[model samples]
Target: MPEHHSGRARRIPPTLAAGLISLLAVLALLVTLPGTATAGGVKRPVHPDRDWMGVTIRAHEDGAGPSAAAQLTASVEGVDVSSHNGSVSWSSLWNSGVRFAYAKATEGTSYTNPYFTQQYNGSYDRGMIRGAYHFALPDNSSGTSQANYFADHGGGWSRDGRTLPGVLDMEYNPYGDTCYDMSASELVRWIGDFVDQYRYRTGRDAVIYTSTTWWKKCTGNNGGFGSVNPLWIPRYSSSAGELPYGWDFHTIWQYTDSGPTVGDHNRFNGSLSRLQALANG
Candidate 1:
């Protein structure tokens, strides 16, 4: 969710370069985080209340980062999060009209979300359907290892509609190499291994979250994943972008990484019954 338009920053410190920008970011972080203790004696993580997470995404007429959401039709709106969102009050988010969520659970085989337990359970408590995601690092570890790590940690599945299937986030590499330097055929093989292991472990196909460009360049425009997995595409400008190489349609479209809530905004492309069917399996 944090990756949008190349200005995305996972947190505040890493992206601050200009002196004035750093000063303003400090001021912004200070202003957003406040005394957040519950009356029930529960302490919460301070939300880094960011307007645009340091990037300039001027989508709406107001010139803010997705300052306004498109008036969606025949769809169920949702949101997603990672450590980038820090601590969030999910109940408040649910009241804002999000029906489901996807939380970044693990990256590769080594990294795990420090805030996943709180966010996952919090979403369920607030009556929002939730799913866990794994940020793929095919170069870092074997696909089986990373998939197992994700599934073992918080990526498990259930029949309850409150829980969605696991998602695999394969995008432009955040580090240095975008494709992890894997050849197109190699990339395809690696992804195949991930899906195979994910289905073997969870008994459900993993959702592939990617952009059309990345799919074409990294996997040589391979459409093989379409058979075993549903597609989730991230396109900020409009909802009518070309579907990736893998599928005829996307089940979920993340229209914007900026929303009225703590994470990137998304929507189910079909009716609630179809969404429920996806969740049931």
Candidate 2:
């Protein structure tokens, strides 16, 4: 694996790195609490049994403890993780107010997250609405090939009303070639190819994940993909800023990379029921 592949959560400019460090300590504590309980009757795990990166991700969500004040701002709060999170305690996350999760599945058609099975299965076993995502590397491979690989590995969708459509994470290129060295039209074409393959395989559109700057530069504010894929916008600051060309509203907003108790906090822009509808697709 290339040393630059640090997963989707850390894909950000160096200038903003210092500002985000303060939140890392707090965010890593999401599943590191010695003892605590959430407001909705979910408690911490008593005997943790999950493992990642040599860490034990135990759960204690007994649904019987003094509830702590919920700090999640959105109607639906969740986390997206890769190997960086290391042995996640899925049940504890649900007990701690995480309603959904998007785990890193495959990247550039060849790289599949080693923890994909554990994270995906753990979230589902714990009753959290779970989905898988693929990291786009347009510079390295065809989008269709990557999409097919993603589905075959872990990004496949179901009508179980709990699996969210797969996400196409095409943002700041982690491996040097930002925009994947593609022209505006070529970038749009690559994304279209990805969306088509994902839709054909899953019978649902893939959510498009990208930052405003990347979208502007690569797609030239292209709205061609608006009808097929909903936008999953990422902004680290307090505000979401301007969105891409097509959508008047975003389906999902990645509000922050570091949460008070987790990494990469995300919000579904609708009520819980509405979120379930999207999941049910």
Candidate 3:
């Protein structure tokens, strides 16, 4: 009655408005944090650090390999690193007896490691046989496209003794479904596409990096790749235990994630000369 009636929004108290803004900010941050829930209620990390080689396997599988002490005694020791390792010290790794390395080069079809040159070349400069690996994301793009992306980046190989064939790191999906929503047959086809394209591009058969559990679950233990692609099997146990269906032996066995100086440690399942033979090929 006192004032002419006109609808107007009321202003909130300063303290309440500030609190509301702070809460909203926190919610936004949580959405992007690693392992936080995203679309479809899947905990996917928005950042690439969580896409490293063994991250999914470590998150999903459980096994204790031989003691790190026992595995460290192998003569042909190596390490695998990604951006998750930042700028690694290759000299320290070489001094610590790391003779070979694999660095993350690309992922999916869009993402390339920011530190690829540093890690890939640094290892070679330090006299370590080095290669690049591509982390597969089948659902996002076709395997041939992803392989082209990888080869165009640092994934190309040479017959020099210091360069190893590029690696295809196929494992559990870190972003969403374990198999990237692809059935076993679909995954096998995708892998076939990738390896075929990679071979066509690089002139060397790409090495296959996968865990036995993942190999069996995602590819139905596909035996077709064993004859052509070298297998790099991850097993944190005393033995690589029965390998996937086709392979009778593992080419490179990643024995422990908690390596001494820097990255995950692996043992070449052969002598140093044999390791050179692989690189030479």
Top TM-score hit: 3
How many residue pairs collide in each prediction? 0, 8, 5
Alpha-carbon lDDT of model 3: 0.85
Candidate 2, residues 118-156, lDDT tens digits: the string is 888888889888888887767666789888998999999
Candidate 1 vs 3: which has more lDDT: 3
My TM-score estimates for the predictions, one after another, are 0.75, 0.73, 0.84
Q: What TM-score does structure 1 among the candidates reach?
A: 0.75
lDDT of each: 0.74, 0.72, 0.85
Q: Where does model 1 exceed 4 Å of error?
A: 1-68
Model 2: which ten-residue window has the lowest total lDDT?
52-61
**Backbone-clash count (model 2):** 8
Q: Rank the candidates by TM-score, best first.
A: 3, 1, 2
Instruction: List pairs with backbone clashes in candidate 2.
Output: 43-61, 44-60, 44-61, 45-59, 45-60, 45-61, 46-60, 48-58
Give a tens-digit lDDT track for model 3, residues 14-112: 999999999999999888664566565534335666587787777777866554547446559899999989999998998888899999998876678
In lDDT terms, how accurate is model 1?
0.74
